[model samples]
Target: MNKQKLLIILAFFSIYFVWGSTYLFNKIAVSELPPLFLAAIRFSMAGILILVIAKLLKKSIKITRQQFLNSTIAGFLFLVYGNGVFVWALKYVDTGFAALLASTQPLFVLFLLRLIDGKKMQKKSIIGVGLGLLGMYLLVSQKTIATSEGMVLGIFMMLSCVLSWSYGSVFVSKADLPKNFLVSTGYQMFISSVLLIFCSLAFKEDISTIKTISYKVQMAVVFLILFGSIVAFTAFNYLLKVVSPEKVSTSAYVNPVVALFLGWYFLDEKLTNQSIIATFVLLTGVYFITSRKRIAKQKVRPSQKT
Candidate 1:
């Protein structure tokens, strides 16, 4: 029991902190490499590393045809469209604010769950979802999204990303994916890398120019491949199997604060007083929903006592 609890906490921490920091790293990487090319290379390297590690450990890397198809679908939804568009939009939007916008994911996931699999939501979840939407409104108004000429397009693209990722999150749970988490993630990344590279070619991003990329950006790519792709994403898949999707998705709430602080500290991005207040509201909403999960235990206890 203790070991299981420890694993859960570790997984939560990996997604919470590592994914949050990725915004800053991704922002840095996109500076020197085009977004699709950057993502393509990052996923390809990470995929190769994961496959190699699985092989060295003598783990079976084989999957059924259904599993391969499922993994590829998830790869397109989560990485190709979701992350790729978000990275492309980072050229115009601030990383902190982009994360804030992405935080709307859980709300989208709620409805998708309802629609896709008939998953019922509790009352507390409804209240939390409403609160999250309000925070999103306040967050966007306080930032460039309200008035910047180009922000409309960026925001639209980000909303599409939220939709894509949310659908992928829900669908992955139903798909017949590989049971070996590392092997599954490796396949997913490899599939996405292929599509992203094709996209880079279609867009005419000069792949040869990557040789001229700065050492700092290259280091950021390495960091993303290791921690962001391998550690955090694998932890996320594990959590999806063991926890409620709503609880697993709560990383959306914590991630914005981390990204916002890191952006302010490292990139010198502005964090207005209003944005801080909105952050509190956002996290409080997440608390209402995630915290309410405990009522299940209390209800179960009464029945057992009788």
Candidate 2:
């Protein structure tokens, strides 16, 4: 209803749809481009675009040495480990299973937060997390991810990516980065770009001719850079600061529904009744986590009740 709440809601939509759709775009981009290099270039371009916007707005881009270090750490954690590995894993797994595996991110986040800081959660949230995990398993269990080699390795790698992303998401909250969130995000993306490019070169990933890549693929890459990196990612960072990390992690739950539907509609991937049921259950968990029931504060005289 209010502007702040409205903005938060809009932010949720940005990450929910924008980042969710990126799985489809990523499939397109990596079909031609080298996965690590593709991610490196995408984030690098997005980082520069964000910096330019920040400069145009006259936002302070200055930061302390510690902030820069923090950005570098987050950069490696989120982008290099989380996203780069994820893109590579996609080659070995189908879209349905990939999104479902990645959706375990919130569970990892919950465990990490509790393990690191002993942050206790309400029973409702724990229940939500449990139901989400079970629902995702049921959704993707029937899907075929075994058509490729290294299926077990792919599963481990995807789960590792989830942990990397979850930890990075939580760490940023305490990383003492720049006050200007955009500036901080720019630094992180830039730092990750450097690391990723280094890895790409180390692996000698061959880059094909731009002319060989289709126009649709190129546009998908551009969409990933602009919307996924700049808009949705910035919104995610904002959400982390304002909301609980567990709550922010609900993107994992919502993302699969979008990714699954888009995969079915565009790529002719299977859409099963089991998957539909999973979506409903996943969304219900997200609802439980994100929705806050307002409780009226009761004012009572001292003599009324103990």
Candidate 3:
């Protein structure tokens, strides 16, 4: 295989495994740590580590003010609202359910892009969006809809997380990002981490709670910081430069499968036949939506008659 193919494979493996495991890790970590506080520390540490390495390599850290402003918005949307609500929702929902809801982000992005950018949605993409939503409905309806106010609120919060992530993705594709993807991402993380810390403090999270958590939870947090944030994100950015954005975006589809499996195997979460059917429908939808544009672009032109 060529170098580009190898990088794509690496990217797939990174996102597939790392992100699949993050749901479980987030569930485990939040059991002991405050969700926002834990996220704050994880991203803050990762950002500092990236900056240190960039400085050592003499990489450019200077970005235009516009780029910095854009990064801040991306970070707030992607990290503060996206990841923050994700962690918060874990307190009320199972890992599998959270992953399932989060997987809807790509579908949301497709519709949002069509509306905001005036990109025409192909029939295939529309079909995909429909199937994905149907799958979500089936998945959620299988469970006795939680009647408790807290559970209802948690579900809405998770949906908000998905919307935030979807909006952030659209902005990332259109924003005036720095020339260096890594540097841009590093700055975003740094800013988001700071904001998360303040948010955590305002919510009155007790840092002392960390000491009471099991060692397994601590290890989970470490894994999230090292693999999920640092390694997986690095691979994602690398793949964006080499592959079509659509291809890289397929990770959204693949990740939920991994999360479901991990949740079942390690956490002993039950997956009903309905869940299996939903996965099939959702995957089929994602494949169609993501590939439709490429298929459209490849149509042969009509010959001119003389």
Q: Residues 111-149, candidate 1, lDDT per residue (tens digit)?
A: 776787686778888897888877777777754556877
TM-scores of the candidates are 0.86, 0.82, 0.90
Least well predicted 10-residue stretch by lDDT in candidate 2 = 297-306
Tens-place lDDT digits, model 3, residues 1-306? 998788778877987778778999998898889999888888898888887777787889899999999999988888888888678888887677777777777677777777887878778888988998898778777645455446667778888878878778777767887767668778988999999989999999997897788999989988988888888888876776676667666776778888889889998887889878988887778777767765333211100000
Segments of candidate 1 deviating more than 4 angstroms: 1-13, 235-250, 292-306
What TM-score number comes out for model 2? 0.82
Inter-residue clash pairs, candidate 1: none
Q: Can you write out model 2's per-residue Cα lDDT over 22-136, one digit (the tens) per residue?
A: 8888887888888898889888998989988889989989999999999999888888988898888777665655776676655566667679878676676677677777776
- Pairs of colliding residues, candidate 2: none
Give candidate 3's root-mean-square deviation (CA, Å). Answer: 6.9
Residue 147 displacement in candidate 3 (angstroms) = 5.1
Question: Positional deviation of 150 in candidate 2, in angstroms?
Answer: 4.1
Winner on lDDT between 1 and 3 is: 1
True-vs-predicted CA distance for residue 226, candidate 2, Å: 1.4
Q: Each candidate: RMSD to true structure?
A: 6.4, 8.1, 6.9
